[model samples]
Target chain A: MSRITECFNNLKSQGRKALIPYVTAGDPDPKITLPLMHALVESGADIIELGIPFSDPMADGPVIQLACERALLHGTRLVDVLDMVAEFRKTNQTTPVVLMGYLNPIEIMGYSAFADKAKAVGLDGVLTVDLPPEEAGEFNRLMKASDIDVIYLLAPTTEEARVQKICAAGSGYVYYVSVKGVTGSASLNVAEVAEKLKMIRKYTEMPVGVGFGIRDDASARAVSEVADGVIVGSVLVNKIAELTGNQEQIPEAVAAITASMRQAMDK
Target chain B: MPTKEDLAIAKQMPDAGGHFGQFGGRYVSETLMAALQQLEQTYEKLWRDPQFQAEFDYDLAHYVGRPSPLYHAERLSRELGGAQIYLKREDLNHTGAHKVNNTIGQALLAKFTGKPRVSAETGAGQHGVATATVAARLGLECTVYMGEDDIRRQALNVYRMKLLGAEVVSVTSGTRTLKDAMNEAMRDWVTNVDNTFYIIGTAAGPHPYPKLVRDFQSIIGREARQQCLAQTGKLPDALVACVGGGSNAIGLFHPFIEDADVRMIGVEAGGYGIETGQHAAPLSSHCKPGVLHGNRTCLMSDEGGQVIGTHSVSAGLDYPGVGPEHSYLQEIGRAEYTAINDDEALHAFRHLTLTEGIMPALESSHAVAEAMKMAPTMDKDQIILVNLSGRGDKDIHTVAGIDGINF
Candidate 1:
């Protein structure tokens, strides 16, 4: 089984929800991402989502958009991000790392070469924000060959027919974007998200991880009630934004919020 | 030059799934899939419906002004001393540009689909003005998302939008340009899926949009074809139009796709020049097949796939990506794409103003520049038709500022 699937299955057997904390790979500073990844695991994060910064992040709101700008300011490319992941794998192998970003970078690298490179770097999964299942053929083929999970997103407006198609294309787990709007833009309607997940569960046995707008500890716990994994992005990335120049405070500041959400999810 | 068969394969494309030979597809956030699918269905159904066609046709005729005259630029042609040049005066439209064509159709679609509000993104503000105009006519609430940079650049148009009762939103996002404005517009549409309809300004974006915008704007090419036959007693040897997101160019080229004898050229804003690495000509230079702003098209992005900033003298041509259909056309050899730098476009702008007494928008000036280049090389018997996509009134300030003139 893939690393992401194995991690999820292990967490399932333990009767525990998965905590996924997302941080842009080179945000604030290039050196802080590795420390943030380690600190996420230290704070009870089962999986780490590393953002590959792009110049234009359409699916994201202002906070994550700013995070992308901060990362791009460091001139960190896809290769540098993979190197960071490889560095993280030297110390920790149990926590699955998902590279999340837009598809342009991978397209530039060519799908086959990117999949191979990502595998060599020990990336567990990929979640391209813009690549839906309809256009993810070569991306999925290459990723499947490399034993990397091809994660898909399920949104509030994804109907039954498309849900089945998306779920069928996806492996590892499905990321359910709880808001209809972009990341960091809206409030999560947990009851509505729960209802959608109930229907999404009909399409696939893969675990559903809820993300987008899960800002606070209470919101994380609320989402964890229905989701197998709670993925928080803008909130943690904002911590790095707040303490950008202070490298010492950046990881701990991000981890403190993540740890609190983890504690809330556990309850 | 592509044969009829080679061109036919590309011309008939965006098959049911909106795939233009592995180029175009629905690559938006998953939440928009069902809504987009619904829009596709509604558009497809209304495309053939006689009433819908009548409504669209009526607007094209009366509301937006149809059959914008094809003028023979005799003085300019004589000056160039080569091919006889003709200008399809889309500049003479009601909103002083070809943008109203797509906006009217989309506003009608919004009316048909029961959307209460219409939102659009604009870089040049022409599309925003067109949308606001149509929304006022149709009594639909209108909002236009323009990049903060664009709002500063085109302050007059921003005020015009406000005067037309549109809530002009300044999108303070990445690069603060057309691409970011579009990103913000898409986000807004996603947020208000039930009541809002996003009228994409150009022939880029996701499925059905490129197709729909092409269908609506094809009136330019359709009329130009008849005008060429009527006035010149034969078809033009070549057609040229400026491409930003490629709507105006595609509009003038679509009807001629099957005409093997008529060469098509798309002019992209070279900004400074391609060699300087500071232009918006994706098809002409720095092009790769990547998904951006809803469709997989020729995008100007870095090695890491991040979309890079595109520079253009014209706000209308300042986009990092072109339409999928244009990419298909360029790839299949049905059409040729080349860049005209800021200096050449400005030269053409002044040449047309002096010789023909017609001032062209900077975006349209690129086409004029290319046409002038090719016209000088062709026989007088050969005709070159250029789609004068917009008027220059809005750009006079820009031109004046560049010339260091106060007024």
Candidate 2:
């Protein structure tokens, strides 16, 4: 089994929802990323979603788009992101890490080569924001061949038929964007998310993680009740943006948000 | 890996799944897949419906003033002293450009699909004006997203859109250009997909957009073809048009794709020059293939696959990616792509204005510049047809600024 599946299965046995915290690799600075990954793991994060920054992140709102700008300012390439994952694996190997970003980078670096490098670096999963199942046949085949889980996102607007199609194509877990807007948009309605999750569960057995509007511990706790995982972005990236000049405090400052969410989720 | 046999049937492109030989597909977030599927289905059904076709044709005739004149530039051709030159006067359209052809169709699609609101993205503001004009005629709420930079550069057109009742939202992210404006428009569509219809201005973006836009804009080539045959007794030896997101080029080239003897030429903006690495000529510069704005296409990107900044005096031609069908056409050797520097385009702008008493848009001047170069090399009996996709009335301020004259 993939590391993502194993981690989720372990979390299920303990009756706990998974906590996934996303951070753009090389944001603020590249040196802070490895320490930040370890900090997120230390703060009760079950999985880390490392963002591979692209020039135009259309699916994202302003907060994460700024994060990408900060990351790209330092010239963070996909190869550098893989190296960071490889470095993190040297000390902490149990926590699953998923590389999340757009598809152009992987397209430039050939899908087969990226899959090989991702597997070699101990990466657990991939979630390309814009690559839906309709265009992910070759990408999925390559990742599956390399033993990497390919996660897919389901929006609130996604109908039942496509939900089944995406679920069958995806492995490890399903990411449900809890709102119709881009990441870092307005507040999400837990009841609406619950309705969508209920429909999604009828399609696949994969652990369903809800994201895109979970801003705080209260929202995280609410989502944890209906989802198998609570995925938070933007809010944490906002924290990093706040401490951009004082880069040393970023790891702890960003981790504290996840720590509080983890505490709320566990309770 | 399409065989030569496959290339022969390239006119029947964008297969059922929207792949144009691994170039065009719906590479968008899952949130948009269903909407695109619905759009594809609706377009396929309505495209064949006689009522829909009749309404579209009626608008083209009465509203947009279709069959825009094909004028022989006798003075300019005599000066070039090599080939006869003809201009397909898309500049004479109701809104002073070819952009309205696709916007009119999409706005009608909006009316047919029961969508009450329409959104669009623009660079040069021609598409914004065209879309806003259609929405006003149809009584639909309209919003246009434009980059902050373009809003400042093309302020006149921005005001024109507002005069037509569009709410122009200024995008201030990611280099603040057309691609960023497109990103914001896509986000708006994703957020409001239920009651809103996105009127894509170019022959780019995801699956149904390129195909539908091409189908609507093909009226350019259809009319030009019949006009050439009726007036000159033969098809023009070549068709030339400027390509940014490639709507106008595809419009003038689609109907002529199967004309084996007629060559198709697309001109990309060479800002300073291609070797200066400051231009937007992706195909001419032999850029790599990557995905951007929802489709796989030839892109001006860095080694890391990040889209790089592009420079052009004409806002309409300053984009980092071209339409995917252009890529497929270039791949199969069915069409040739070239570049026109900013200076050459400006020269052509002045030359056409003086000789033919017609001022072409800066974007269309790129095509005019290439035709000037080609016309001088061909025999006098041979003919070149240029799609003058827009008028230069909107570009008066830009030209004045370049000439150091206060408008």
Candidate 2: tens digits of C-alpha lDDT, residues A87-180: 9999998999999999999999999999999999999999999899989989999999999999999987788888999999999999998888
DockQ top scorer? 2
TM-score of chain B of each: 0.98, 0.98
lDDT of 2: 0.94
Q: Which residue runs does candidate 1 get wrong by more than 4 Å? A: none
Q: How does residue A40 of candidate 2 score in lDDT?
A: 94
Instruction: Kindly report the root-mean-square deviation of model 2 from the true structure over all alpha carbons.
Output: 1.2
Which portions of model 2 show Cα errors greater than 4 Å?
B1-8
Q: What's the alpha carbon RMSD for model 1? A: 1.2
User: TM-score of predicted model 2?
Assistant: 0.99
